[model samples]
Target: MFEKVLIANRGEIALRIHRACREMGIHTVAVHSTADADAMHVRLADESVCIGPPSARDSYLNIPAILSAATITGADAIHPGIGFMAENAQFAEMVEEHGFTFIGPTPEHIRIMGDKVTAKRTVQSLGMPCVPGSDGPLDTVEDALATAKRIGYPVLIKAAAGGGGKGMKVALGPEQLREAYQLARGEARGAFGNDQVYMEKYLAKPRHIEIQVLADTHGNAVHFGERDCSVQRRHQKVVEEGPSPALNAEQRAHIGGIAANVVRELGYRGVGTIEFLFEDGQFYFIEMNTRLQVEHTVTEMITGIDLVREQIRVAAGAPLGYGQDAIRFQGHSIECRINAEHPDTFMPSPGRIDGYHAPGGLGVRVDSALYDGYRIPPHYDSLIAKLVVHGASRNECLMRLRRALEEFVIGGVETSLPLHRRIISEPDFINGSYDIHWLEHLLGLKG
Candidate 1:
């Protein structure tokens, strides 16, 4: 076990890693930007160091500064809590070269899976069902046209190295393809530094389901089941829940096994998620997230497994404590990503937090990095916290989440609480009959 570990990111994820380290008797060193000197994670950690300025390029995402902080603090391992350097394959290699453990998948796996084109090919090799589309990166409009022709109409163009719903465009016919192609390519290049785009058949009204998987260096892998993340705006997830209300028994097992098979084949380590789009009762692989996801707490709540501790233990060369059969998903769990924003228009609202009050009660768990006086930072993601609730059924879980959100209050900044209140009461959402397009349609109706 490592005596100390350095957290390489900020916000609630950083605090989550710090708490996990403390419970495991490991000292934690927090690296923060000049603007984050007084952040919650910095104050809670055992040691702290200022890495760089407020800009992400000079701060949270700066490799040299973080490495120096780890060296100065004598941390043998580094936990890239989320975002920024979490999925940087080259950075993972650098950490290893500096004799510090990167608490995630191997650099080889990260490099292979980070690129959506390469990831799809890898999964295709395993005989998994992938969306009918191009096998590699599409470089030009001509290449995209050919691929779209092969896949049929209503094609989707997406960034090869994209996540969080960025850099995506759909063209319903050939006439619209050229404009959508350039737009998606431009967005992809701006976001991932690679203009590589891929085309796929756009399945209508699909439910987004992802399986949570964990693997050890000892060749052991198991899945904790799936989460329904169809609730979203602009392709980013807002609300998520476990044991999707749409999945039948056989389909659940099949999807879970399909995800687990990929983990074993790729030799993936630590906590990861395999996302798939399910439409008309058929499933198609999308991509895999190479690090811990924001909705990880929902999986933990149902499975009673500390995913962070398991991630650390795997990095330390420890074997998995349980196998496939030993794992079980109990009850339904729901997570609402509470962000500081205008729920109606979904705009960012970062400012001082006054009269803050978080939801509390049985079955209510809030994963946040906030306080009564904490000022929400404008330089990063506007997400302030994740509110997760567990219950025996989906109805019970929704009720708990509704109550929790009602009890939640944060002044001085607009939040999505009112939006959630409306959604939770919507008849379609309550009946679990909504799809990925449902949220967007609701927005259009209000407009």
Candidate 2:
């Protein structure tokens, strides 16, 4: 086991890793920007290092500063908690070259899965299903048009290195293809510095489902199960739940088995997520997240597994002591990503929280680092907390989620609490009949 691990990120996720390390008797080194000197994780970590100034490029993404911090603190491993440098393949290689464990998948796997087009090809070669589209990135408008025509109308142009809905555009017909392709490439260049884009058939009402898998160096791999993340806006997940109301036990087992087998075959290590788009009882591989997902709380709630602890143990060369049969799926679980933003307008709301109170009860958990006077830095993500709830049944989980949302209160800045409350009360959400476009449609963002 590592004596100390440096967390190379910020916000609640950094705190999440810190708590996990603390429970395992591992000290933590929290790296933060100047703006986050007073962050909660920094305060609780055994040691804290100021990596750089407020901008993420200078601080959270500053690889040399982070490596220096780990060296100075004598950290045996570094945990890149979601976003920033979490899925950077070069960063993973650098960590290993510097003689510290990167507590995630191997750099080889990260590199293969970081690019969407390459990931799709690799997984499809492994016999996984994929949406019909171009074999690789389109080199020009003519190439995009050819691929789009082959895939039929309403093709989705996506960036090879894109995420969070950036570098994505949809064209309903040939008339719209040129503009959409150029726009997607432009966005891709701006966001990822790589204008390479690919094409895929756009499913109008697919549900976003992802399977969580964990593997070890001992050739053991197991999947916890799937998360229903269909509730989204602008390609970002909002509400996530386990035991998707759309899938049955057989369907869940089938997908979970496929995910585990893929990891085992790829020699993948630590935690990863295989995301898919489900429609008409078929699953199409969308992309894979090579790091711990923000919605991992819902999977943990349903499976009763400490994923962070498992991730660390795997990085430390510990074998998964069990297999798929030993793993058991329990009750339904739901997680609402409460961002520091307006519910209606959906604008960033960063400021000092005047008053804060988290909901407490059976089956309810709040993962947040916010306090009354802790000023939320405007430079970082707006996600302030995660409200996860579990129950014996989906119905009961819905009821519990409602009560928990009502109890949550944060003053001096707006939040998405009201939006979550409204979503829970909607017929589509309550019945679990909502699709990826449900939330946008409900908000009148889509026609």
- Per-model CA lDDT versus the true structure: 0.90, 0.95
How would you encode candidate 2's per-residue C-alpha lDDT over 144-231 as one tens digit per residue? 9998878898899999999999999999988799999999999999999999999999998999999999999999999998999999
lDDT for model 2, please: 0.95
Off by over 4 Å in 1: 445-447
What TM-score fits each model? 0.98, 0.99
* Candidate 2 to truth, TM: 0.99
Highest-lDDT candidate? 2
Candidate 1 lDDT over residue span 1-447, tens digit each = 999999999988999999999999999999998878878999999999998888999998889898999898999999997889999999999999999999999999998889899999998898778999987888888988888988899999999988876789999887789999999989988988988889999997899999999999888888999999998887889889888989987898898898888898878899899999999998899988899999999899898899999999999999998888898888999999889999887789999888888888888999888888888878999988889999988889998988998899889899998988888899998998888888889878423
Clashes of each: 0, 0
What's the lDDT for residue 123 in model 2? 91
